[model samples]
Target: MRPDPEGLLPATEPVTLIDSDGAPVTPARAAVPPASELVAALGAMITARRFNDQAYALVRQGRLAVYPSSHGQEACQVAAARVLSDGDWLFPTYRDTAAVVARGVDPGQTLTLLSGEWHHGWDVATHRVAPLTTPLATQLPHAVGVAHAARLRGEDTVVLALCGDGGTSEGDFHEALNFAAVLRAPVVFLVQNNTFAISVPLSRQTAAPSLAHKGAGYGIPGQRVDGNDVAALLAVLGAAVDAARTGGGPQLVEAHTYRMQAHTNADDATRYRDDDEVAVWSRRDPVERLRTFLTRRGDVDEARLAAFADDAERLAARLRDELAADLRHDPSELFEHVYATPTPQLREQLAMLRDEATRDTPAGGSR
Candidate 1:
């Protein structure tokens, strides 16, 4: 039976489980994961938020090249990582350091690229995580290829690709979605619609009702969930992941979240948006919303919450110490990962670079 195109489109009203007030907006529809999973998600969110804080601090101190803070969107960040299996792969954006950390990639190794140390920062095979892509939606096509290949091998491995709202505008985004739909690839596209693409707002990006609505154009099912509600995110994203893994084809999920901090350490959010708007979103903060909900339900006591905080602090301290250390990178590595088998031109360039490092290379003024 063919699915209805309109039915595949996301609802006008984003799905909401817990409201900003820590109450269920719709008790009937707010079916969350089990208690243990919710508790784990809460802990992960705490750690992720703390990780963002520490990374931003490193950026300010000039320890890193730059950092894209996932401060206010911890719900989707954590859910993206937690809803995957060990064999599944994650394709993260530059802003998804929090998601990578949640997936068990060592914090130091995860930050290696951002710290300007190495290109292949961590062995992707180690955690099945792709390199944190910074070139907009380029990773989308790569993810689709991987997921489609996995299907060909009869592997039930699912691939979750993260993208910002701005990335949806890229040509790769369209190509990937169309290819995934045609191939019936087992992939989930998680778009964190944080309202702004650096300085440009969503209004300027597209006139579509929601980012999720764009999925219908590619013949994929889509859903939109309140990104600040951890419960809602888990339910929505988990279902999407499950569907993709079971051969239900690709899924597109748009998380309506906000970026509390500047786009990156190098950006000034104050230039465009006002504080009043930020304050409005602050009331709908993911971390506080989850904490309030958990406390009210007796799922977490003061002791447990305090323990989560302590654990997060310890993790942040470790990352700080590692990032603060003096480090140097091998300059020759620039040409190493360019391709699997280098062409003659690349080989010649690699030789030239290596030879120059050994000799006193001519400066631009002399050359």
Candidate 2:
């Protein structure tokens, strides 16, 4: 059979294994992974949800400076982190704290950046995860660069870089994809199409039929998947990561999801979207769908599910207690990591800060 012309092809459908009602749309193929792995994925999603809830509560209580919740998008975060190996690197945006935690970083350390207490909460080299980037799409180019460097160094490394629908509009996003395609860099770009970027909906973000189609222009293959479906996300991301590790070059996966919470503690989502719309997506909750599937398959019983809930609660309690403690911030940390060697200006500034500290202290006592 002759293939149809490239541009005349139909739009790609979002890949899905299960329906919104928690029923399988097709048989679980051998590639679907073992039941034990799926159950662990579910556990990660539940833990992430609990962490997200506690982070938002901490923000309200003034324990955190700010938080960007990934309440409805836990599946994407968990799947992305689960697919990577220890040698692989992850480049996460400000909204990807869940992804960081899933990669085995301490939950408390993950929130340190948002709490405004430290530069990055965790060491990048030790974790193989980049610091959470607040600037839109900037991490894409960095991921590309690292992937390309690793290839030159004769190392088997894959890099997964994440961005939101709104971030796809940034110049760095385009440049990174173009470079990766040209260099055949081992990197995977995952764009979470969470319906809205802050108050701006996806409709205003671009006129393209779908975000995945953007990959075509850059000579990279793209696939769309149901972001809320943990099983589907795991299957698709696992394939993509494997392909990249095997010299498949760069690929893009756009996961369609919804942001159930306000953009942050400061913005109000009700101003732009109504309750009815949110109610619709709420029915497609990632955690509940997986739980229902597991229950039906006898992979998990009600007792086991209850135990998981208890575990999540204990995690939240620990995070809450850690955040409630009085922590000291060294003012000198500001100028410490700015440069490998301190510049004359930085030294002068450090001196000024020390002088100010001396003046603030009592003459006969230490601060």
Candidate 3:
């Protein structure tokens, strides 16, 4: 594909459709998206934006201890999530809750996960979306393992692993890619380069030109795309997922995006990045870009956009209420899943703890 240098996308190079203003830019000419698809994409983008906003608010209010914001990277996530097949597995990081929601997990259930009420949120096995791994870059090897298992079982399932650019530095990243390549497992490693690992900039992450180039070392196909461009993100991920489903081994995709918000509720980005940098990224807001594109093309009118916003608000309110009513896990429940059968030492410890609790209680009181 030829690069469109005129379109100033967030990436170092541009190879996607629909610029930040929603102009339909082609290799030869610029145009617009189809009416129906454009409206749907617009609605999805709006809903996703609202979802991220509400999630951030909840984090600030202490409803959630910490949250990795997906404020600016929703396009890449939503597009990728939409491309998954039924049997495919998604290994997502902490910041990928949006993609998880798009892949069929309910936002309420996500709240449960983030709140630490559940260990395996949304039944990963049933949902085909694995539990969100907080540890950096660990899920890549797990995705490779899932792909290998599917192959052994004669199942045509692909594993799509999502991670941030900072995760690329881990030893597991290299190990997982090498193993997948050697075994020819069906997997797609989607790297969302938001240019920061918490407060650390991409300059400290790597000297490589792009994360895609890292795939060459593992002998896999490598590609880069404008992560903020919804249509282009969809097209690229669609092709990659199709290839994986059809027996293609693996591919590495570096999605160039920006983290418009802090890394998480606990982070303060201002200490590391200047206000000017944030302002630059704000101009490329994926949600606003798509909305502008849809409006300019007459694909979705203002009333329709308003309706989407209304629906998103209603959904967010419902999620807030539902999460409020869900039971918070008992602290003791933490030990429940630690073993299939308790070891002798663990059993003795539990017994001792139980006796101590009983002894400490008042004569007629139950503890």
Candidate 4:
């Protein structure tokens, strides 16, 4: 028998396998994850959290141009990478450096976009990860198109597309869902509903009950999971990916998480949000929750957890060493990647900039 199309939705109350206090909750909506996966998730979240902290520090030290800290959302970021295979593609946004790094992209490479280097620091084709798209919801359609094309080519590939809460309101988000639903593309949309789209709260953003409910309108299944709970995210995202890989069509999984840091290092979250609210979410921190659970079950100990921290430190040291270098701008290189075929106007602007830069440079060619 066919399933009810409208019945495709997240289980009531959002799947929360592990509560904020690090205790396993009763009657979880999804299957309980194994000890191995749980430990792995804990390690990933720990590493990711440390890495995010380092990136934020880099931004402060001016080593990075900017950074969007996924401080409290490490579970969503790490689990997204954990569930997928190397053959799968991940469409990451500017805020998903932790996820990108977890997918085996070099930490230094992921920071390139934020560091104001090239469009993306690494080779997209090599890693099967797309560029860090900054524009909201633009990558949604791109991901859908790639998934559909892969289907046409008979490739066994699935695409995981991520966006923020703000992206849900975008027209591209709606269009992408419609296309994926109609085409049954092997793609999953993971919306990290981090409470706010910049300064706008979730309540002000939409009145549609929940973001996951948006999928109902497009004939796709939507599942809302506790973003801070790595176990639930892994279970739900794993199921979504498998279903899509088979013939179950696309899936939309919403992770109800929070952005512990400001939207970016450039913005001040304190101006809009009070300290109490942050404190409440801080207690629900994903990394702490997973670590607490694992430690309680004897799955992990402080020594092992410290090893993870050491690993994170090594990666951060590498990023610091790599990004700390002073880069010389070739004024001309800017116009090169802007277009495949340079526009006449761009060509004129490029020439003018080159002339100005050359004339302003020191005669000794030092400046």
Best by lDDT: 1
Please list the residue runs of candidate 3 whose C-alpha ends up more than 4 Å from where it truly belongs after superposition: 1-12, 28-35, 118-120, 325-327, 356-367
Q: Against the true structure, what is each candidate's TM-score? A: 0.93, 0.95, 0.90, 0.94
On TM-score, the stronger of 1 and 3 is 1
Q: List the residue pairs that clash in candidate 4.
A: none
Backbone clashes in model 2: 0
CA lDDT, candidate 2, residue 367 = 94
List lDDT for all candidates, in order. Answer: 0.91, 0.90, 0.80, 0.90
Predicted model with the maximum TM-score? 2
Clash-forming residue pairs, model 1:
none
| Candidate 3 lDDT, 148-178, residue by residue in tens | 9999898999889999999999999999999
Give the alpha carbon lDDT tens digit for every residue of 1-367 in model 4.
5458668765678999999999999876778799998987777777898889999999889888899899999999999898888889999998899999999999988998788786678889888899999989999999999999999999879999999999999999999999999998999999999998889999998998789988988888888999999999999999999999997899999999999999998998888899999999999999889889999999998898888888888988998898888877877688887889888998999999989978999898866
Q: What is the lDDT of residue 336 in candidate 1?
A: 68
For each candidate, C-alpha RMSD in Å?
3.4, 2.5, 4.4, 2.1
Clashes of each: 0, 0, 1, 0
What is the Cα-based TM-score of model 1?
0.93
Candidate 3, overall lDDT? 0.80
Ranking by lDDT: 1, 4, 2, 3
The alpha-carbon lDDT assigned to residue 307 of candidate 4 equals: 89
Residue 122's C-alpha lDDT in candidate 2? 88
Instruction: List ranges where model 2 is wrong by over 4 Å.
Output: 1-11, 27-31
